[model samples]
Target chain A: MKRSIWAGLSGAVCLSALALSGAAASAAPRVELQTDPPLSQIEPFSEPVIFSLKAVADDGQPLEDAILELLLNTPPKTPWLTTDFPVVEGTMLARLTLPAPQGEAQFQQVPPIRGSYQLQVRVSPRVPGTFEPYTDLLTFQVPENPVKYRNLAILLSILLLAGLGGGWVIGGSQPPNPGEVASRPVQLVLSGTVLVAIATLLYISITAERAGAHTEAPTGQDNYTEPLNAEPVPTNITATLEDQAIATVGQAIPLEVELTRAETGEPISAAVLDINTTSLEYERTVFDFTAQTDTQGEFVWEQQFFDGAPHLVTVHVSPAANSSIPFEPFEFSQRIDVTGVAPPLFVRLVSLGYCTGVLALGTAAGFWLRRRSTQHAL
Target chain B: MYSSKLSTLKRAKQGVLSVPVQAILFLSLGSLSLWMLFFSSYPATHNTMHQTRHHTLGVGCH
Candidate 1:
């Protein structure tokens, strides 16, 4: 009887241990990505490159209903000439769904600039909480296009020469005369041109700011409160905006984010959250900051929108070291409308200064030529 | 006064280029300067004028 009892106890303990190990195994599913032509062979300003991705379980079986999100970021070191161009300096997002037949998906993008590109791949199940999400950061370099650079240099040189030649001939020939009254039409046209130029500059400045036109990393990895863990725990993260319709400039926009266990609805606390606001119109990241969720598994913050436009707010949650409940790192994004406002006085003044400086230089050159012409006449 | 006006007109016409032609040349120069300063894609030129592009023109560059 004593031997039978001991045997029964050992059997129950072994069964419990096996169940826990099985649960842990199911929690860790990995997504593997393969790039065609490989990353090393990618040439700048070349044709679009394809990225092939697959998600697999621990047993090496492909996960058919997996979704992959790819975030391609330009190198932080190099500044792009224009964010308006495709694949220039801003972040590009692509989504891929692995269908049943091949259990793989592909993404294609054209790399226009030459620099180190960081591609962040995040994989999760179609249905939340099936398994812990997986994220991988891959870096690749695109070689500089020597031909493009050479052509650019030649074109700019020609423009510079043309401008200088034109300015010299115009100034030398049409010297300004204080005694000779200018025609009414000529004066009108000159003033009109200056006004139009100033107005255009001001408009462009305001629009560019609203469009979030900057070439900087959306969010730096160093800003994270804690480094992401190798293996994240299974958790579901969700975020909501207080007023989803419209936000006003200079007003505080409230945002709330939470993390919880999908199965048990239990809150997960002490998660590090990276929040970034990107302007959709210009595809530029305007605001990026980091925060932590409170004990109740909630993070609430107020952000003041600078530009009036449609903005995407993205929250990336990662596990914190001292957290009682481990949680998987995941991203949540929401789009909101922001009302526009007039460009500040300083921006207008700067635009005016640029226009005035150009006009003044031209006027000064004309006067100098006029003095020399008058001496010859005398 | 009429002779003075005629002499002034003759002097203006005696220059290498006409007034209209000079105006066009000056406008071309202005256009070229604006394009190079604001819209040039060359890295060296763009990077060199990076601050003026951002602070003065309100064009966003990092």
Candidate 2:
């Protein structure tokens, strides 16, 4: 028993040492990317997303001869989109396709109405056994399109009118004569309701916006030093706003704050700024975040607002912890006005509801008239 | 002569087709027309349809 125990201990130690050596030999590579659509993500079902990616080695060298495969949530074994082309200038740009439906019960030609999907980007160095394969996942969103309401409204209206008209004509007390009365209030109401519905449907179809019809490409360069806020705060370090455009909901708001010294006119780099934002529509604990400026003495915060409410933001710029001089905190406030556009689904539903309610009343009136005529005939 | 005409009309009213059947047929036709027009609710992935013969049958262009 003692001899077997000693042999087992020696084998275990040998296996562990081999495992450590194997781990040290193989190392995962590093990947850095700056892409279009602001980030690598996109809104699904909207448009074909075009993006550029940058890949480099651990020593900060560009991998010019890298094999890349773009897969959509598929296993690594299945590579539909493969390229052996070198990533020249450490950058590669490609257009991603959003498939269109071919026919009924077909493969995924179009994206789902509402859901999130992962886009997997796999990169492998061409040099054999040098670096491990690197994969990155970018997520995108697809909003649901509510299209049932319009169809329901139209079909229901047609059914009601067909039933009422058939009953009225067949169950009438007498056939029309040349000297019969011309004006009929119930029939006139029925005609008017149907006319309104037809007009509404036409208007909706003409005004509705398609998802990907007007998708503009993102500017390929990153230039953060653009013109900013109108007002400049007077302090040891001043803040200048460079962006003055309205931000839409579910869209990125580029908040640029430029910092410069008042006395020496020198740019302050790596300074931290405290951002506190509050929404006017909903009151809650203030949302706070801290960000450091880049080498250009500017910090650009890309904020996305899910709601359409106005955000009142207060930014307090302060020096770094290792600064030689300590000054008072510079505080400034700005109001961000956000606008929300109703999705096509919401508009379709409201229009359908309005038309359906009016048509129901008209159909009821026709039915009453039909019943009265039938009693008189009997 | 009026009584004979009335009898013919009554017999025609009691013909082979019934009112309930007529109503059912009307409803079925109405529903089928709507289906052909507005089948907009589609699944994200259509592996089955794509494999089958009816792969290119898309609806709701207008």
Report the number of the highest-DockQ candidate. 1
Lowest lDDT sum, 10 consecutive residues, model 1 chain A, at A78-87
Candidate 2 residues A220-291, lDDT tens each? 422221214523455566667544457664344566777778788677776667665556545532244455
Supply the DockQ value of model 2: 0.04
User: What TM-score does chain B get in every candidate?
Assistant: 0.56, 0.38
The C-alpha TM-scores of every prediction are: 0.35, 0.36
Strongest candidate by lDDT: 1
Off by over 4 Å in 2: A1-114, A117-135, A140-234, A244-253, A283-289, A303-309, A339-378, B1-62
TM-score of model number 2: 0.36
Q: lDDT tens string, model 1, A1-378?
A: 999999999999999999999888665665566765677777643455666667777667886666565565665522223221222243332222222223466645555455677777677776688766787677777665455446445544554453343334444444445554443434444455566557655655565565455546555432222223322324353333344325665345556777776767667776777766667656766555555666677766555454455677677778777777665566656666676543233433443344434544554555456556667887
Runs in model 1 with CA error above 4 Å? Answer: A1-252, A259-267, A278-290, A305-310, A318-329, A337-340, A345-350, B1-62
